[model samples]
Target: MTLKHTILLFTILIALPMVSQDTSSSVSFWNILKSHCGKAYEGSLALPEEDESFGGKKLVMHVRACSENEIKIPFYVGDDKSRTWILTMNDGILTLKHDHRHEDGTEDDINFYGGTASNAGKKEIQFFPADVRTQQMIPDAATNVWWITLDDKTFTYNLKRLGTERIFKVVMDLTKPIALPEAPWGWVD
Candidate 1:
């Protein structure tokens, strides 16, 4: 082969792996969730106090819709199927948003409230502080910070409102794959 062609081929070979390599820990975290696509898990609140909205209810999370840049997981609290967690990767940054809907599939006024990762967190965890939009939507939640931890055994979703007593935590067992739940409200499939 010609020297020019050989040099070009060598360059492509050297850059191929780098192109496919994870750009950041956020991507690694995304890959971890993507791996669990189409699966569902059961969870329970870890906080000592029982929450009225979540207490005494069967908690289930279905990792339903997944794509190259987004994953939508429907969170079922007993018969209430009004919440879904939407995670999207944009320009190497991961953003988490909550989609709340009514029984008729209508968007809730307090929907899409979440934040983007402040930095590239660890492969197993990422933290999202309340964004400007979230602050505007829920002034009381301005100090809110949400995070998720995913590993082989457990996946936990947590929230803590800074300078307040409000906190929510739910831990799902990853090892036990439960039966898939129906799609959340406002979800087509």
Candidate 2:
């Protein structure tokens, strides 16, 4: 083989492993989320001193639906059943979206606001910065960064608005799965 061909082949071989590693981590993270597919976990607000909506309310997250490339989780706050989190995986990339609906099962005006993972995160955590759609729909949240951490005992969802004091976090105990709540609004099954 020519010297140039040898160098090219060496470069390709070196890069292949990195890509595979990334894919592995991403898939591992997906599987971790999938593992709780049929369970419901109770959570509590863990950040910010006070919030009108979430504070003093019973928080629950139901990993209600799962598919080969998608998972749907309904997040309930007390009596409100309007929020569902949808995670989708495509080509080893994960996208997070918030699906909000009204009591009548209609999509909210500011729905589906979330972001895609910037890189292959670890098996236990992933970060998603605000995407263009999120920015355009909610200008105040343009600098938002959302992340989730999961383990055998706990799962936490977190959010931070860069350059601001706005932050939110909810911690769920995975060791105790609660009874599944009713389906969120707009969920067909």
Candidate 3:
């Protein structure tokens, strides 16, 4: 191939990726969650300072979107069969409801409702406990229902939007530290 032709082709290849990157379709909150419907992510629940006295132990969250409106977060403490939690996120609110079933589907904990915010990523929402019934909750970190925002082209999940490109860090209190109870679902040579 001629040098000029090769150079032109290389430029196109590099520019093509940039063009695609700059023209990504705007992703919506609902759509983003929908795409992660059947996927589970291993995450740790942030713990407080050792001397803070929160006493929340480590755990592993089995986060899965059971349906379009429901995300089920099941967790186990260490490798014990005794301590477990079944947190349900319906619509946009979360409740620490108990699962009366074994991992194989046999009954266990008492079910109850709890308070959570419409946007879990909001700083103000994380600052204080919010009651769903009362019209009082954290203000919007940004416009729309997006729990996350794009800042300088980077995805910022937990933020309090003051304005464009301005955000406050969300201070989330840990109910428990979600540790890896087992190895990630898949790994093989």
Candidate 1 off by > 4 Å? 1-23
What RMSD does model 1 have? 7.5
How does model 3 score by TM-score? 0.34
Rank ordering of all candidates by TM-score, starting from the highest: 2, 1, 3
lDDT of 3 at 119: 40
Model 3 alpha-carbon miss at residue 80, Å: 4.0
**lDDT value, residue 57 of candidate 3:** 41
Q: Please estimate how well model 1 matches the true structure, expressed as its whole-model Cα lDDT.
A: 0.91
lDDT of each: 0.91, 0.92, 0.35
For candidate 2, the 10 contiguous residues with the lowest summed lDDT are 17-26
Tens-digit lDDT track for model 2 on 1-189? 999999999999887855343577779889988999999999899997599989999999999999999999999999999999899998888899999999989999999999999888888898999999999999999999999998889889999999999999999999999888998988776
Residue 152 C-alpha lDDT in model 1: 97
Q: Which residue pairs in candidate 2 have backbone atoms (N, alpha carbon, C) closer than 3 angstroms, thus clashing?
A: none
Evaluated against the true structure, the overall lDDT of model 2 is 0.92
